[model samples]
Target: APLGISNRDFLQQRKVIFDFPTKGVTYMHFKSIEHPEKPLVKGIVRAETIISGYIIEQIQDDPPITQLTVISQNDIKGLIPKYLVNLASGKAPKQWIGNLINGC
Candidate 1:
């Protein structure tokens, strides 16, 4: 989700933490939106982890989307878009600090 990533790759590799609002379950993965014809793996997070840094790139479509990229402790890379992210308790990347403070 860096500044110059393509939309296809952005959608395929962004990390997302999915919290089941009513089920009390949490899942984390490199999110891939479900497609109609073929099924793609939704990177499911099975362990507890904290993401320290993120590279975010946003796309302004009819429904704007944000791409989130993270490098895991094991050196694995993951990506997810903003719409798929649950921002309730998550913090924005360092690059976004100024924008957040400016109320943008």
Candidate 2:
């Protein structure tokens, strides 16, 4: 992250690990660890939660297709509403996939 740990919005993630479990498959894992501080906030208080997830990318060679699958749990721990998280989470993967496709 360009802003390092103190990002403007949320705390920048510390690490991302990439693994190749098979010949044509790649797995990316990310998780929010136990930070020494409570979550930061701008207007509303943000709480750190157990945000863990993995994304899988599998490439098929016959017709040349890339399959992407993302699974995550991002339940915030403060007074933040569930609906807000749901909305943001729903939109994030689509944007990622779109960007990846466009880049390729």
Tens-place lDDT per residue, model 2, 1-104, is: 12222222334364444566665566665555545784555654343435544555546668877676676565444444567657767888788678867998
Clashing pairs in 1: 13-79, 14-79, 14-80, 15-79, 15-80
Q: Estimate, for each residue in 1-104, the C-alpha lDDT of model 1 and write its tens digit.
A: 33543222222334444443223233344433434554433543222233333444554556977655544332123454544343412443443465644895
| lDDT of each candidate versus the true structure | 0.40, 0.55
Model 1 spans with C-alpha error above 4 angstroms: 1-52, 74-104
**Model 2 local distance difference test score:** 0.55
If candidate 2 were superposed on the true structure by all CA atoms, what would the RMSD be? Answer: 6.6
Which ranges of candidate 2 are over 4 A from the true structure?
A: 1-19, 34-51, 101-104
